[model samples]
Target chain A: MKQFLHSGFVRLAIVVVMAYVIVSLCGLREHVSILSGVDESGTMHLVFGLIYILSYAASLVLAPALFLAAIIETTLSKVNVLSRKGQEGRRLGCSELRERQRLRAPEHAP
Target chain B: MKSRLCISAIALILAIAIWLPLLHLFFRPDIGDLGLEKGVSRIADQLAAHHLQIWTNPDLRNRELAQMRQLNPEWDFMSRTFLVMALASIALRDESRIPQCLETIDLVIENTLLIEQEDGFQDFLLGYGYADNWKVQPPKSIFVDGEISLMIGARRMVADRADYQHLMAERIGNMVAQMTLSPVLSAESYPDECWVFCNTIALAAIRLGDVLDHSNHSEFLREWVETAKLHLVEPQSGLLISAYAVDGTPLPNGPGPEGTSIWMACHMLQVVDGAFAQDQYQRAKAQLGRSLLGFGYSREWPRAFAGVMDIDSGPIVPFVEASASASGLALLGAAGFSDKKYLRQLMTSLNIAGFPTRKNGTLCYQASNPVGDAVLLYALVQGPLWEKAK
Candidate 1:
């Protein structure tokens, strides 16, 4: 579980979900003047804009980043495991072949 | 560590690449549903339904008007005019709903005239009009007279009311006498200040008056149009100057196509000169219309014209130059011309940005005041009245 959580893919999916919730809770879409860099009260509605912008950034930007990171990391880890297993199998095969050879040589020499 | 960092960097780039282009999809509305099919569009029906509720519910109507009155009392009067016209258009389109729409229309017209009678014409005049003797000695405002006349004309077009006809004729008589006497052939909406918007509406009222009363004003309407074409146009834009003095001199703002004035004027202009009106619509659309990220809006002035922010323009958004006021009126222009693409885009923008609030089956936009809502409602239901008048 710790290893799973440590995976970049899992962490990014969590960030995307959290951001979606935050944006929904904040009611950022209702403050559309933030798109124009203004608020309903006619001043700069910066905080709302920032929250929405960040949420968007996370969804499109950070979340995607995390997903890609996760995919790459998972792919790399799987490759590493497969390659290690292959090496171990080869080493075991070599040892088994030498043992068989020694047993055969003893029979022939006697 | 370096390999991990490199992976993270690539992921970040990939995420940005994936998300930026897809963002608009999140905001994309079902545009096909809003297309003009059957007699009206879906958004138009929703807007009309919302307005029907307001006209029936006194508390809601008053609550909406009170906010507008606080900002500018003129909106209180204008909102009534737009609502009455909207109801007329809806009544004509949907015969089954006529009885209910007429009830609200009558209530609006009756109450509006009553306010004008009790409060006097000055009651509707804005602060600038009331300032230090801009009005003639009799203190009549063409703005008040023009809008009220059009309201009465619209009401009669739906179903004639004898009392409204009498009142309309009386107002028309006064306007004709005034227009005949003025050297520039224009009437003042304020003290010595004439607006193209008011003049076009007043002219439309006269045209409707001729239709309902079997009177002739074709010659007069023609003469006024010629005069406007010759003198009222801004040299650069070829659009009529928004406001002018009694002697045909343009206001300081020059011949700019103001968002608030252009669409509504083009609407009334259809009654005066259909060809000229279409010309103005195309020009105004070219000058003011803007689209961004599939959302459409309008600007207060054309790119060639520079102006400051005012109540009519609302706050101008920089870079894109989106004006809330212009965008609202753009609906009228788009609907009038049946520019389905622009209309669809504007409506989508409205859904995304207009801050619509729906409750108990009634709807309103929180971002807009009563007048803005009325203008939008007018856009949705305005077709029938113009067709009937024509």
Candidate 2:
């Protein structure tokens, strides 16, 4: 779980989601009317609006994408590890069979 | 670790590749069901509910109007006009809502007239509107006069109002007299500055007035169109210029063939001269309309005459040059002309970027203000009113 959290994709996804939640909770969505040239409050409002919109777009598109990518990466790596283990197990089984055949040959040599 | 990093990078790229292309699908509305032809669309209904609530609740309406008036007083006035027009269209579409729509329309008209009476016409104009003396005497803004006229005329179209008859006639008369003073037969929305947007709207109002009162303004309307074609059109694009002088010469430094003005101009012109309006719509569409990957938008100016952004254009998206205001009005133009494919694409873009919000059975776009939402509503429910006027 700690290693999973260490993944760059997962960390970025967490950041995006956290930022979006903070922006949403701050009620900055109302400031987004600035895009339509409706807000005249000040640069502060514009800044807030831009932040809110960026966070929103990130949350909607980027966060999901990052999470999906992380999940896929984890799944692929897991499959790789399992396949390697399977190959090692098969190799060990073959060596054991060879050793058993060697023992049987010695016994049949007489 | 390195392999995991590479896998993550590739996975990220692949995920983006899959997601970006599919994003619009989630926001894509079924265009056919939007009621572009007849009946009230679901979107229209929800948008109307929001506006209707605003009108009924004075506190809410005041807050919205105050927010708009801070940026541009014109938006406040235009919001009322667009809302009234939308309500009238909705009323026409759904017979059962006639009473509710008429009540709201009357409320809007009454409030507008009261403001105009108390504060004067400049109440609805920008601060620069007072900078230069109006060329016409008694200092009336056709921007104010024309839109108010259209609002009244639209209301009367749904059902006759004896009180508004004289009001409509007076507005039409003022507009006609003032417009005739210009070489292009246009009136100024600002001092010495005539807008195609305002004049076309006034012409539409006059046409509607003629239909309602049996007044004859056909010759004047025809002459205006001819003059516009001869003097007001941008040669490069063959679309109408956005602003000009009272003498009908296009302002050298002014906007040329702007989407913000042309789309609504085409719509208003539909009632005056169908062929000319159709030509303008096609030309405007060819010049200003743009779509990419199923998302549609409009540029404020054509490529040959890429103008600076202004209040009318709203914010222009860099490189692509998408004007928020123009795109909103383009919806009206596309829907009015029944350009289904463009309309669908535009709606897709709208649904994605407009950030539609719904609460208590009402819908409004978080990215839009009262005027923008009203414009969207008018776009959705535009056809029946225009058809009735015709």
Candidate 3:
């Protein structure tokens, strides 16, 4: 659903999973020499190396960042919701009390 | 969908930004962590054992050697030299291993000389080595002669072999006579190409020959050093030029560090002249050495010089100018001079970047071949040989 796709946590999870898949599929970690754009075969493995490096960076760096961002976003949104509920509750309570007081004022009036 | 994707992208970028700076923290190597000690390091023992295993077992040795020979036969020959030197140093360190080391030394020497005799000196050189006819009457490559002599001299330094003693004398005699005859006191390792690396190894071999035979070539070494100081130095970088013509003309790629070349030059120079060797190491350190996020490496050329990438330089990483060959060999220079800081940094880099693989009690870098591993082994155990020679 659009709702699920819009969820920040779900999006981050997708990215992390995608990166993990690509990283595993490419066998990037085993080819660390790709960082220098050269492999043991003495040819430029730059494209593969770039993919490996990027996937690695994403896995280590971006995944954690997305998790942190989702945590902060969820926490802040929850706090906002809770505070709004508390204010509404207080206002409703005050209005209800006023109504009772008004109704009782007539009873207790001279 | 677009908004969600944008959010995800932003989060990813921020995460990557945080991770990139701290990534090296996971790889930062302490000197202790690298197994570096006062004399021979633990990694040295492991690497030496791996090489010993290869040499002792023909199946493993042939497979490894065939891989290198497929690329360059010169690497196969050089691997023999480096392995012999490493084993000699290890023997000097541990008396119990002397017999085993000597056996391997004789085996390597026998095989190398056999190859040279059957295939000729051109067998030990790149095809370009014989690209043109030699200016000198009879073509003898200092590259083959020099490394072979050092191999022989190192063998004698550990324990005298009368056969190798004669071979060492003969090789040094030829080198000395060749230098004496040349106008600039330089001899060719190829047709007209002379490498400072081969010449330095020849000088070190001559010095070791003196230690063994009690015949001093002190004056000749002194004159050669003087000539090199005046002509062989790259004025801009103050490091010795890598290659030159027989007439002492600096080659087009002359002034570059050429990673594999400089480290060996620095190592061999230690025996030829300690003070000068230290000076070369320092200049090279200032120019080519780099440490980023605790990982140390060496550049193929100083920042001031624009150089080409060759087989010797290997592939150079763009921003840092880190050469695979140079960075690996930087260990030799760092260890040779007792430069603990750089040594530790370089070791950390090797672990982080060099793709170390150990299986069944033997170790080798997956990213490097047999020749690279042999050179690394020599760098690790190199000190003992120099100490004994001194």
Candidate 4:
């Protein structure tokens, strides 16, 4: 679980979601009216507007992307692990068969 | 681990490939059911509800006006005009709402007039408007006169008002006198500066006035069109120049064939001269309109003209040169001309970037101010008013 959480995709998804939530909670959305040339209260308003816009873009585009990437990464990792285990089991079974054949051969040789 | 990294990278690429194409869908509005032909659209209703709320709540309306005035006083005035025009259209479509719409309209008109009376027309103009003396004495801005006339004319079209009738006549008479003084038959929005947008709007108001009051201004309207074709047109683009001097010389720094001016000018010209208006709309669409990846936007200026960003153009997006003001007004142009394909694309763009917010049955765009919202509302409900005027 720690390994999964440490994945880049998972970390990115968390960052995007948290940034959007924080911006929204800060009530910065209204400052976005700066885009239309209104709400020129001060430099801080412009900063707020730009920040809100960035967070909005991230929420809409990046968050979904990261979510999908995290899912795909997890699924790929799981598939890789399952396939590796299958290959190991097949190799073990082959070796056991060889050992049994050797034992049988010695008995037949007498 | 290297293989895992490659897989992760591929997964991210695949996810983006799957998502980017589908992102716009989530924001796409139902254009088919917007009821462009008849009835109020859902968007129109929601936007109007918010405007109506602002009008009813003094505190909210004052705050909005203050914020807009801080940036540009013109927006505060234009917002009133657009909201009144939109409400009038709504009243015409849905008769049940006529009383509500009229009540708000009256309040807005009265307040606007009161301010103009107390502070002069400069109340709505930018600071630069006070710099030069208007060539015509007892300075009156056709910007104020024209839009105010349209507001009153819109109200009377729905239901006649004796008071507004007199006010409309006075405004139209003043506009005609001022326009006739200029060789180009255009009045100034600012001292010695004529805007095609303002002049076209004045013409529209004149047409609306003639229809409501049995006044005759056909000859004047025709002559104005002829003059515009002769002098106001930008030779390069064969579209109307945005600003020129009263004597028919293009301003040294004025923009030629700007989307912010041409689109709305085309819309207003519809009732004034349909064929000319249609020609201009087509020219603007070809020169200024752009669609990329299913999103529609308009350039502030044609490629030949390299116009600088101004208050009217709002912000110009780099590379694409999409003007916020132009794109917003482009909605009106597309709807007025019944260009469904372009309208859909523009609306798609609007939905994606417009940052629409709905609260308590009221809708507003977070990225848009009062004027922007009012303009959007007008675009959605524009047909009925123009049809009636025609």
Kindly provide the TM-score of model 4 when superposed on the true structure, using C-alpha atoms. 0.88
lDDT of 1 by residue, B1-390 (tens): 776566556656665566556544555556544434335556556766787776678897777666566667877888788888877877787788788878888888788788888977877777776665654556678889988999889889988988888899999999988877666678888877788888888999999999999989999999998998888887788888787888887777434558778888888889899999999989988888988766789988889988778766778889999998889888888888888888877887777667676766556675676677788878876777887778
lDDT of 3 at A101: 94
lDDT of 4 at A75: 80
Ranking of all predicted structures according to TM-score, beginning with the best and ending with the worst: 4, 2, 3, 1
Best-performing candidate as measured by DockQ = 2
| Model 1 / residue B70 / CA error / Å | 0.6
TM-score of chain A of each: 0.65, 0.74, 0.65, 0.78
User: Residue B176 deviation, candidate 4, in Å?
Assistant: 1.3
| Cα lDDT of model 3 by residue, A4-103, tens digit | 3465665876787697787768676566554332234544455665666667556655666666566544545556668879999999999999999999
lDDT of 3 by residue, B1-390 (tens): 564455555655655566566656666655653323544566777787788898889998887887677667778888898899988988887788899999999999999999899988898787877676787868888889989999998898889977777888998999888877676787888888888888888889889999899999999988888998888888887788888888888887565556678878888989888888899898899999998766789998888888888777877888888988888789888878878888888877777666676767777776677778888888777777888777
Could you tell which candidate, 1 or 4, scores higher by DockQ? 4
Query: Fraction of native contacts in model 4?
Result: 0.67
Q: Which ten residues in a row have the lowest lDDT in candidate 3 chain B?
A: B31-40
**Would you estimate the TM-scores of all the predictions?**
0.80, 0.88, 0.82, 0.88
Quantify all predictions' global Cα lDDT against the true fold.
0.77, 0.89, 0.79, 0.89
Tens digits of per-residue lDDT for model 2, B38-142:
788888889999999999998998888998898899999999999999999998989999999999999999999999999888989999888667788877788
Backbone collision count in every prediction?
Answer: 3, 0, 0, 0
Residue A62, model 1, lDDT: 61
> Candidate 4 clashing pairs?
none
Candidate 3 chain A: worst-modelled 10 consecutive residues by lDDT:
A34-43
Residue A27 error, candidate 4, Å: 3.5
Query: Which prediction has more favorable lDDT, 3 or 4?
Result: 4
**What DockQ does each prediction reach against the true complex?**
0.18, 0.49, 0.20, 0.47
